[model samples]
Target: MINRIKSGIPGLDEFIQGGFPLPSVLLVLGEPGTGKTTFGMQSIFYAAKRGEKAIYMTGIAEPVFMIKKFMSSYKFFDESFIENGRVQFWDLGTSIQTMGPKKALDAITDIVRETKVTRVIIDPLPLAQLFSSPVDYRRYLYDFLAALRNLNVFTIIVGEKADESAADLEAYMVDAVIILYLKSLDNPLVYKNLMRIRKMRGTNHTRDVLSVEITENGMSVLKLD
Candidate 1:
């Protein structure tokens, strides 16, 4: 069998038997300050090392410079990566502000066509959903995924969870769903981070609730407690 495209995300790749299948939409869900954006950025940087063209698309208010600053702290985010045309950034904040998800999708499609991106990340999709209904958001997501699949690109969509309902539309639309949770432990009086591979279509993924942490270098997957 052909080895899957490994994301090189420490333990994550091993959990998926390799990594996400090519041309699949992987949902990375979490609450605020849980490192979802960092994880997605690191994934794009990892892809760039393999000579893949990557696009970091965001729906948040964060400026590209700020994203690059965080990414630059990691060894994988090298200047040559951008200089050599391996990585790019696209901010959808303004587009989502002016147009809706449908139009925003058109803008995204135009970027993909112009860049031949092999890996793409969409940070904090809730903003895009604000521009449209849940049903319309899901439809646009499906259409976007179909377009990405046609282009043979692996896509990562980030979502912030206000509640379980935050994942309803995405869980039904994407090829894979990864949920990150933060729990308080009374004994230690500390908050513990956890991640679950809620689902991954067409692959035997690890169902264990694993721990995660962010460092000056970047996010790392820790062992399940």
Candidate 2:
């Protein structure tokens, strides 16, 4: 009996057997302009709207205010949802810079436990920058995910889809891998935004590429008609 956490992405849950499985970490890979942040934020905010405690943490070099301003333009960006503090945001770049990877990892797990957050989003997780060596990075990733599982939270780790193979460490480490692409569409296809689930450990998921849309309303997985 796997408890599923609803992502609130229309047409998406049906593809993944109701929703994302609980107590799992999902890696979302995407290139620039692929709406990775939008997808992560949309899911987190949607969960918050449904009375779930959610937090968005940026490991990248983005400022919180600027992110808020950009996300504010979205229709689902609710001040009410954010005001209750049930939905929160954090900048982990500062922590990584000051505390280094190990302490920063501890800080992350500490707050998540303290806040009792059920949903978490880590945007642009650059493992290379997080550690000095590949061995250290792999160890950190393993520990990071182990902590997440122990905490029993559903997490989404958003990252750049630079030239990488199926041998990518984080991709192999997570429970699922979802990739978003900014593709060109013509008569052969009707939409540009595309999505695919490369792997889902516990459920039967679609291998077929799906179409998506990102507007002021937020990201939505379009139904294949």
TM-score of each: 0.89, 0.94
Worst 10 residues of 1 by lDDT: 125-134
Alpha-carbon local distance difference test for all models: 0.78, 0.85
lDDT for predicted candidate 1 compared with the true structure: 0.78
Question: Which sections of candidate 2 miss by over 4 Å?
Answer: 163-167, 187-191, 223-225
**Model 2 global lDDT (CA atoms, 0 to 1):** 0.85
Candidate 2 at 53: error in angstroms? 0.7
Residue-level lDDT tens digits of model 1 in 89-151: 777887877886678888887898789888888886644447446666667777887888778
Alpha-carbon error at 179 in model 2, in Å? 0.4
Record all residue pairs in model 1 with backbone atoms less than 3 Å apart, i.e. clashing. none
- For residues 115-180, write the lDDT of model 2, one tens digit per residue: 999999988775566588889988988998999999999999987774346448888899989988
